[model samples]
Target: MKRLSFFVLSIVFGTLGLSFVSWSCNKKETNTIVSRELSSKKTYLYEDVPFDSTKVASFFVKYPKLLTFQKSIVALYKNRQYHYAWFDKKGVNEAAEMLYNKMSTVQEEGIQKNFPYKTDLDVIFQNSKTYLSPNLDAELLLSSLYFFYAKNVLTGVDEEATKKIGWYLPRKKLSYVSYLDSIIAKPELLAKDDKVVLGQYYKLKEILKKYRLSEQKGGWNPIRVAPDFKSIKPGDSSQTVSDIRTRLFATNDIASDNKSKVYDTDLVKGVVKYKKRNGFKEDEVITQKHIDEMNVPVGERIKTIIVNMERCRWISEEFLQDSEYIVVNIPSFKLTYVKNNRPEFKCNVVVGAMMTKTVIFSGKMSYIVFSPYWNLPTSIINKDVKPGMKKNKNYLVQHNMEWNNGNVRQKPGPNNSLGRVKFIFPNSNNIYLHDTPSKSLFNEESRAFSHGCIRVGKPKELAYAILKDDKNWPTDKIDAAMNKTVETTYSLKRKIPVIIGYFTAWVDDEGTINFYKDIYERDNRLSSILVEEE
Candidate 1:
């Protein structure tokens, strides 16, 4: 095969914009793609050996199954000007070896797709003497394998699939070409403890490994359901109590498994801790529902953990580094505020019901409106107001609502649907966080009663935290504004990013894994796609 010149290859693909020439296949050649501007001129040059188009074409022909990654593989090669990225004069480089090992054990990362060229990759690494020369086939195969691993692990199902399943959060876009460049330059980074996926993803993987080991060692048996059992409250004694004890112990909800059949004080404490972590009421009672949750097989729980890991992959680490931000986890029915990489506080929140699910997205919280008027949405007006008006002529008067320019809006006060204050994050979805008069709903184990927007339980505390740094809004002023009958809007000097996300499984900073109900039924939808691919 004739040696291909970098300048010639660039001209053939004029879109690459070639202006200089340099070529070498020697071991000492620099592995770099440089683009610089000369005196009133732009120049592009590759400081490495360029691959022959004929060899790349022949390799694809032999391995036709990997044609799906043809575009990506070509782009990757063009980015480096066909440099031997996966190998040096000695043998396969460290990055290639590390990626090969990761691909071989991709299941540990919750990926189930089998590599298409697994045997070919094994042969190259297993017997390096037979593949001594700079093998284009091995290099291309590694590049293609990396893309496959990244697509399934780093990026979940495509954006369209996620959006179809009601996940509207922005999908993370990563440049594998640039990522490979960095890895090739510093091989040690491949071995670093730093996370390549989202921070939560790494945490979930750690939990997954433990769970899989548990599953392999004969997981816990299902708790027996008694025909006469109504509920197991504190001080109740039965075989079920012993089963609960063992189950809770397996999950570390209880420190010990004494195997005692009596529901003692220690058992009660364990029940409370389990309920709190599982989004149930923190009471010393074990109902059938709680039993059902505990009885969910470890295998199914593993699948749930894997599904949430894919969700973590969608989030960008850049967002987590914000100086100040607000994150509302829909499944957990909780909101957390973070400042300077530390969680300031967390509060209970009420999200939308199944039919009217809150959108999963992110925006900037720029304003806080105190005693905000409730401009009823069209759906609410058509569904509730119009029908109620037909039954009662004075419905508007009774509800403290009035007609404002052909639209009915509730007056700003304690009676307003948006109870005392509202946090506005401008977006097309028209959803925001606000206070509600239905304080009792917050006490419910499953608080998904809102129309679409989030109903915060501690609106006053949230407002105080948001405006604590600003001298213009003191505690007295904030209280006064919230109590006023008229609507008052305050613009925040620095906008905080608000991310409304859905995560059914999460690991807290304390390394405790908490699981929540998939309120919107999104897990099965995502899991189905993964299963189909598998």
Candidate 2:
């Protein structure tokens, strides 16, 4: 009787232990959804902290107290993301979780004590990585709680982090922050900024409680992906001219020239201001040429957008350390080399025509020259010169072009075609940029007007930049170098990589994905292969 009773007790205890294990497992998950109070778990976004350039580094480092409120933030700081790092799905999930947890731990009170007065998102996006440096500020240790980790893996810290704080609770509900708007056409809460945020932007935040742009189930939105690059095919006369132009000069950067586009004198000039701003001919007429420009295929435009987008993506910038860098928007027919974050030097460039469109690539600024000489490309000689020589026999002499394949070479002269000066960034394409003799084309907008090269808007400034690095080779000497065949290379202390790119749609400085007319129209053909159309 004793043995049977003991066995019964053992069985009962074992069942109780199993029940306890299951209860604990279920409780943790339930706690995540129901137990946490929204008001008790307060959070902040980028606006809570305003920028103060003086206190950068100290604000970005990790603190022992931060670990007390947050465990995830500590794990994130420990992760190392060096180049050539491979990321699998597991890594991505963990990183995202860590981010969500860290953002939740940050409190408004903590930000007030730690950061400079009224810090915002810009300070974190532009300067947080530098704040992580050892040379960081002492004030940051006491006050600043902002820091960047894993390079560009973190960008919208202040604003983005604040939104993430909501994840610990239920996701489908709603947010007071307008940027966190869900299906509702309006945001729960918002700060009045005139730019487009995540969703539900209110125009006059004061007049109305909120205004929202409802999410559409499906319709004609993706049309902007490669937008109709060409007009609705040729000979389709039913379409209004304005409709065609509306899609053509839709870029926010450009405006239509003459609003009164009647089919006479005014129409003859065709979209003047838009054409002019884009470095195209200011003729406002919607002529056959204009139609052809509008008719460029969608496939080519997609290629342009993809290539240029790649260029922007490749730019892993930590901060705008240097105020400016030379930017050559290949498809746009313009060049602006900025300084101190402003366009100090801008020039009209003659880029490659469709047939010999310049390859999208990049290199660095080595130096600029005062007087630069031109070494004509061999391809030009073969394609342009040899054909002309066949007709004129004295073709080489007329253009001052000489050819003796055996131990002799063509020398430079007035008709050499390489113009007075050129910018050099040596690459595999055998394409060294130079000035051109056809200066009038600079006035045209659709400047797909070169034999696969780039022409600068301001040639003189480029000349100054090239030679400025060489102390002995003063600006005056640059002009002298041009007349003489003195081919010299001015190496840089650090050669910055130059990226020659082609993009049709890009987010501007204000973070808006501004679209352009895909001159080449190649996106659809490529995108079809890469993405499913449904």
Candidate 3:
């Protein structure tokens, strides 16, 4: 691979700028006096060697910054344990050590915890003459992380669903990690006299520079006071109105004895509204939720967006240009499907409740079963099943539940726990999309109500839209499979990709971020990781 010019590398990093990982912990004052290996470090010409051998070991000793850089890489792997990155047992421990070493180096430099160990993106770009760009580094890092993340996660995969994954043909190749090698090796960006290359790099630098970190607000915080008179609605308490409006109109310097200057009604309303929006009782008082949002100050919202912009950098860069896909915004409880290149449909889909927050991931629709039989997950079976089984083994028969070998499954019917239909894309995680009979729960504003499976709204419409492209197929075909007592499966002619993502702030068609509440708390969790990477 040729050396990637600074210009080209910058552009690539800008688009996917947020680097990887760490945890959201309070920043401890880095006063812990840990002993550093006093032997001075030295850097040599870059050489590819077996991972974790002398070459990598030497690199760490030579450039401590490389350690910081490696810490960021390790973070990517650690997060993968939670996401779907693949690795084996030995790989997992090795990667963990790499991250730990890097973190130690940063700690020696008085770097704070919670903040990611920072490396200058430009420094690595310049190092391409000797060392490869981070693009290559990222490829290696992702590879290691993928191996470990996948390995660790697979240990926890449901035994029943494990067999189903290989059945779905692996059509889509994972490309981004491999692609980095080709991208960083491109020389056009590296040509020293190429002003255009430099200009492109600068432009991308400006773009990445725009990404500010999201505000790391936690616990109860302070509040601010703002008064607006026009917000007074009908049925106002005259005394309340008089007192509040007086404050709005009151002189800032007034030490005068005004007996009845009430609270800033609008500010209080902002508080009440904030409280109402969050999972809290809306009492319009200057309570915690209101105080936090109010104290955030409008000036900081842009900073919040900037931080979110950095977040885009944290995702895989090789995105799908064409596919039918569904994205459920947990904060919004809304689902969107994009066909070709435009959003063709949207619906309000319910997600897992607070205790069982919906995990964000990406997947594809492999098969949709009509009048689907629900295989009760072991976790639920242990919690909800045995109780019902013990209380009434008849509960299983009454609900058409049956045991296949050791796996407990429900027979397809109106009363089955899974409601009527299910959309399955075999993943290592065993999570799926399905329709639920608990329709009334959807009406709730804070609808995080499922155990794990995504409960789609108007699943019949989804089924039809997915199948409409097929020739001569009608509802009767579906009816043919469902009417009979046997469990039936129908694979679609075209598979739809489904991405369960976590973006507290994301760009719309206009490229403006439509900020949503961080329902899964992923933003803060990942935000600290991003900070740690830096």
Candidate 4:
């Protein structure tokens, strides 16, 4: 790798905006002869030349608008050892053309940022002969353009912007320098699915297209019904039933649209499916609430899907590389344990309420504590314990709480706030997954009643799964540990990655779109930012 001697930002060219003519025909003729000779000898595609760093610095100085990508372009040249990546002996490489097309249609990729140098780039692409000679300006411009596209489409909004909107998840880190090296080696990769972005992003993009098409078709009509209608059950006949059938068919919740006026078995099945997808109870009964949800404008749903797509952009492809991981989606109120890239099991979970919203982040679950004590936070103690103790003098004894080192802590028992076990992943947020004493809360469709930590609905099953590989802790031993009065901690031999995320819209494995209420009103905040920018 050759290093550039000249500072890219130091030199200034006054005629940068003026378009330069293509290289002379004599130079093209000389390159043509050299190209034929190399092809006839069956040697390398293009001969490597010593890259002049001074020329690259001069190119950047000419187009100061592209100075933001100067460092990335320098790294790219170093990786390629000063070789021309976008140009071969014959002409401009296919990868450069594909990249230009991708950048031109970035809006189709859900990017809102306008490219400042797009007009200059268009001039370069339109002139076929400009790439015949080793043009440093064109080469560096395309390299900078690649980085720009990678940052906007593959990476996402900046970290500072996401933090301003309350997203605390670790942003995905990628080296565009190395990525460009790989692309230069194999130009065909540009046309293939690179798997650079999250798989969910492409899925949501497809759904977004479908939704926008629906919106263009004037969207679906709002279901009309009398105010007195509290709920509609199976076997009921009304005009609202026909409207519901049409709405379900439009959304592909049902296979065919019979336009039936009666709430028959098909309609009941569709309603149940729709309910389950929307985080509602899987029941045959349809209430006014369901009708209201269906009445929401299609444009609004499209916006929600787009907002969630932006969230997906923040996730890295490295997450899919892990063989075993746990994902807890806050809005969905569900915990999924995936093994071998397949979901092993999913269980209901209770997340933090709006006032005490759960933090979005990732951690390594390295320990599980059985028969755990509920070490109440100071806020909880001052807010709830003191108030209760004022009313009932025996509050501490009745709740099995004791004063420990001048702080209140609940003893391990069936009635303990942290039921019988807790999964620990140390972080500054002081959040962990634990079992709750109130089991009935899991039965409810919406379970956001916790402080900041997550509550597992099936804690015993989770314990068994986490320790199933360890012969020392069998199923019976696990149960015994949970039932014991003494708190026992087990260090996991293999730490699983746990990711807590917030997505109000998700596509399931069956291609069904699931929508949930923005429990913390995050979607609106993000949507407002995106709209304001637009």
Candidate 5:
């Protein structure tokens, strides 16, 4: 509601904080130029007034920055049968004012770029005499502004650009033409920001405001730690403990600082909370890496949040509609099986190593293979199998692998590379969730040792959870199948959607914002692109 201050058509022109662009128009032109008609009647109904369709092309010729939206504008007016959207017989309608206010203050949406035609737009609403009258420039500019808000605040960077940043999730396509219809029917929809963006984007926006406020107040000083600082356990006492407490308190990680040089129980709670919120192992011991995380500049953290907000824009809304689905956050190395909009189960996972980064995409998991054979891909065969065969006489026999029709395949057993089970999604990347014989790899803090496919730590538990409601395969049957040497496949009656997403920053269900290391070095790349676009 506070943003409505900009909606007043009579507001002083200079107060808008942009230079004005003056224009002269021919009096004979029909909606192709601004008209000073003081007695123009204002009407609330959109269909009551129609503008010349040919003027749409001339409007773009004047404001070239908005030329990109020319086609969308044409389609929008055609959909409305060339009716006036932002104006009525009385004056500028409430919807146009709302859009103008939003466009004026897009910085709150984590967009630093200034609207290209901000000055030109400000001139139309310079005074009630001009804004209240139906002006063709104002009508077309408001329409262009709608799309600007849609792209920056709702849809984010283009789909192809997202792919360049390694985000493979399907982008949500929005038809602003139809969206505008809904907003006009209920102008109150403009007040609900979350209605435009994913709820996650709104949460990040809230945190971004907090971080910006903190930055204004001189964000926390970096905590000092020794180069060889192995760790400070619960009972340890050192000056660094006091520094850590102060740092945590600054970020609301701890209830109070206490300013004590002791790693007391209170500090342990703060440490554990901070660690958990940071995608670290929930531990009271403060390690060097933890201190480094705390020392990260507040500016960098703000950028990370904004970058992830862009990513949230790319996620399809249909992802939230599924009764059941699985989400694997590659940076967090975590897999969560969600059902009915709640997390059913969560487990640690090992993603692809740096050299062989896992592909980010979505797929429908329609089948599960129990006691599956590890069909090694050609890349692995040429790189690992043939080299081993050349070095040792019985390399295949020693590793429980055999040549099957000129291809190497590991037998289905405890030693099998794919361990006991594999969840198949049938993607071109040859990536799937599977149990791994190298189970100990999951114990590592940063688990990214796998060749490509994800290695689930608790494969049997996940299998049972997925088949819990199915009468054909109970927990016992799943266990029996997992233990058997023969490979068995079961088709699921209903496919579960699996989304492999990469997010360096995410707000958890508990409302705690979590930050993870950019394992694939993607955060900066995306952040740079966003700033460049600005």
Candidate 6:
């Protein structure tokens, strides 16, 4: 495509907070640019004028902190044949101003630190008239800043860095050089396109704005609970109710705060909303635990949202767009089966406890096993079975376990830890979803009692949902298969992608943001990495 004419480019830049000044290049410079452009095979989209190639090396010397982006910067200019991407014969282009504006409000995107050389950027844009013609320093600075924004806001930490921090789900890799081409063609998308970043990032950003606004307003006061009471039941009159009302209203959980001491209907509605938003049991009763959750400072909540936003960057928008898939957010203790870009069902789940934390990863679920034998891992055998066998001769028989080929395997039964079914998505971590005999564990708001695999509270329902379209597996056959003493396995015709992820803050379907406890204490570490990068 031909480069946007200077008149059209001027209008675009003027709209992005930078007035364009038409520059009069000497006849000699114009001829040189045309000769270079004609010799090159690629079409120009941003500017035809090329900058000095050696200055890119000097750019790193002048702004060494942005040296990390040197590779991407070099590739971008090379792709454009060393053209002046952020400038033209008119002045600094629209894409440059858009990037500058994005960096200026970087914190709004959950970034905590300013971009390196932001002051230098500010001076150049502030004095755009002085640099109306192609300037090497401004050109390279914009290129470096684009990569910085792309790294922190678009792609997040590198895959190795994420794996070091315990995130193993596939990271989305993008060609920032190609992305710059598209952004230069249509600069408005840099500010408004949801596809550029994960849709979840934008949703979390909306919540981040409200929370930051709440922080600015001094936040809500902690709801004080009475020492004598375990929970404030409905219709109970107390000051705690009044405080909760104020707190809920402050967070927009309720429409308004009447500030009444009585546990009225409005206050009860707000209580359930607050509980639901905080990944607690949706109930009218207000307990000390709920009070403690409410007492968590808004600043800490903001940090959690910011931390999860970084996680969103590690994800691909296209991954979530798959026709069918399953995702389990460990911190939220919930699993969602999505089909056609909508959640088919969301069920409570028990993830691995703090000791044997479930790994965050992705796999393709290919099989379903009913009345599955639980082949105890070596760790479990060493930790529990060997000691139990030493303590009692009948331990294996009592637990309905047997030695099968030098491995301890629990027989298919109601009391089996695998319950009556298991969904297998082969991974190196050996983590999969399965039914559990400990159904009561799901009753607790914090359900992290498993060893390392996920225990689905509604495995049968999940099976039904997965096989609803299939003609071969009827409900009666599925039920019979689970009740049979012999283990039965069925391979799915179409393997579903399964992603086991961790997010402490998520925006729900109703547009309300939810905050769950950092079950594995991951938020602080991730937040530190982001700040350290800054």
Which residue pairs overlap in candidate 1's backbone? Answer: none
Question: Candidate 2 residues 359-428, lDDT tens each?
Answer: 5544555654323434344555666666787899886666554555522133443333455565656665
Candidate 3 residue-wise lDDT, 1-534, digit = tens: 132233222222222111100000001111121112322432111222213322444544544534534544445434322221212221222232343344333322212332222243233323434332223343344344333222221111222232232111111222323222222233222122121122222232232233321122322123223454233333344354444333322211123324343444444553343343333445644433333443453324443443444333222222323334555556666666655544555665677766665655566678877777666667778887788889985977887788888988878776665556677776665667667777776666566677656777766666666676676457777556544566667787777766565444433322222345556555444335435543
Number of the candidate with higher lDDT, 1 or 4: 1
How well does each candidate superpose onto the true structure, as a TM-score? 0.88, 0.46, 0.51, 0.86, 0.88, 0.88
Backbone N/Cα/C clashes per model: 0, 63, 28, 0, 7, 0
Q: Candidate 3 at residue 36, lDDT?
A: 26
TM-score, prediction 3: 0.51
What candidate 6 gets wrong by more than 4 Å, as runs, is: 1-42, 226-229, 382-395
Against the true structure, candidate 2 has what lDDT?
Answer: 0.37
lDDT for each residue of candidate 5 in 1-534, tens digit (9 for 90 to 100): 111111110111111100000000000111111112222442235566688898889888889989889889999888778888888767877787787787787887789987788887787777757666678888898889888887888788887898887666666755677777666656666656443455667667788999999999999898887767798998888889999999999888899978999999888888988887677778777788899999998999999989988887776655534657777888878887766555567788888877778888888899999998777778778888899999997999999888899988888898887889989887777788988778787777788777678889899999988998899998989989998978999999999888788877776544567787788998889888898898
How does each model score on lDDT? Answer: 0.76, 0.37, 0.43, 0.74, 0.75, 0.77
- What's the lDDT for residue 11 in model 5? 15
Candidate No. with top lDDT = 6
Candidate 3 regions exceeding 4 Å error are 1-295, 298-303, 378-393, 475-486, 510-513
Give candidate 1 regions above 4 Å deviation: 1-49, 188-196, 379-394
